[model samples]
Target: MNKQQLQQQIEQVYLDILIELNLEKVDTYFAPDYVQVTDHITTDINEFKAHLEKLKAVVKSLTIETFKDMLIDEEKQTVFLRYDVIVEKKDNSIGNIEVYAVFTFNDDGKVIACNELTKEYDEQVKGLGSI
Candidate 1:
């Protein structure tokens, strides 16, 4: 994919899957063999799905606060993204997290792997980045 298309794909994944918690969109944007490593914890597609499910259960709302940076490496089929997120839990507590992630896509433009790091900007939520 071209740079623009790849950038759009990355943004759409954040909008559709992460912020919206739309589990169905996982199939549309992610490869079946997808894997992710977040904060040194690795998870396969099934585990990823479980994490999302758990997130859905606890989170009342999630917002993308800002896209700090985005870079596309066309030759490597990878995109690097740094963003901040605000999350509100069911109990009405809020937390902020800053995430730096690298996404690698397949030729078909579906995400196949990701390596991510997250920092908790506030103490309201512990381990919020992982789930």
Candidate 2:
């Protein structure tokens, strides 16, 4: 796909999946064999879905505080993204995290793999990225 298409897809995923926690749209953006490595911990599609479910249960809202960068390599079907997230829990607690991620899209435009690193903007809120 071209750069604009890739950018739109990624942006939509962030909105529908990460911010909205719409689990039904997971398959639309991710391949069946999707795999992810977050903060050196690896997880497959099932694990990723579970993580989203957990977030959906505890998170009241999630916002992308900043989109620092998005670099796409269309020929290689890869994109790099750097962003900050602000997550508010149901109990009114907030956590901020900064993330840098690289995603690889399959021929069908589904994400096949992702490698990412996240740093807590404040004290160590464990598993803020993958949780």
Candidate 3:
């Protein structure tokens, strides 16, 4: 896929899967062999889907506040995105997080792998601060 197409697919994953909590979109956007790596966990497609299901059950609402600096490399079939997300839980507690994610797509334009780094914001501090 071209850069523009890749960008649209990536955005759909965030909008349709994450923010919208539409688990049905998982099969549409991700390859069967999809894998994801993060600092605390590595998950294959099934495991990832289970995790999302759990989140969907517990989360009252989710919003993507910003999706910034999306860069797509057509040659590598990769896209990078920086984003901020706000999530409210069933108990009404809110959490904010910033993330940087790298997504790799297969030739068929389905996401095959992803790696992400995230920083959870402190409700008191507003920004990262020294202890």
lDDT of each: 0.91, 0.91, 0.81
Measured by lDDT, the strongest candidate is: 1
lDDT of 1 by residue, 1-131 (tens): 99999988998999999989999889999999999999999999989999999999999999986788998999999999998888899989998888899999999999999999999988876787777
Compose the digit string of candidate 3's lDDT tens values, residues 1-131. Answer: 99889988888888899889899889999999999986557889998888788888777887886787788999999999888778787878788778888999999889999998778785732321111
lDDT-superior candidate, 1 or 3: 1
TM-scores for the candidates: 0.96, 0.95, 0.89
RMSD of each: 0.9, 1.1, 4.6
Q: How many residue pairs collide in each prediction?
A: 0, 0, 0
Per-residue CA lDDT of model 2 for 1-131, tens digit only, reads: 89999998999999999999999999999999999999999999999999999989988998996689999999999999999888788888888888999999999999999999999876535576878
Where does candidate 2 clash, by residue pair? Answer: none
Pairs of residues at least 3 apart in sequence or in different chains that clash in candidate 1: none
Model 1 TM? 0.96
Q: After TM-score superposition, what is the CA distance of residue 124 in candidate 3 from its true location, in Å?
A: 12
Which model scores highest in TM-score? 1
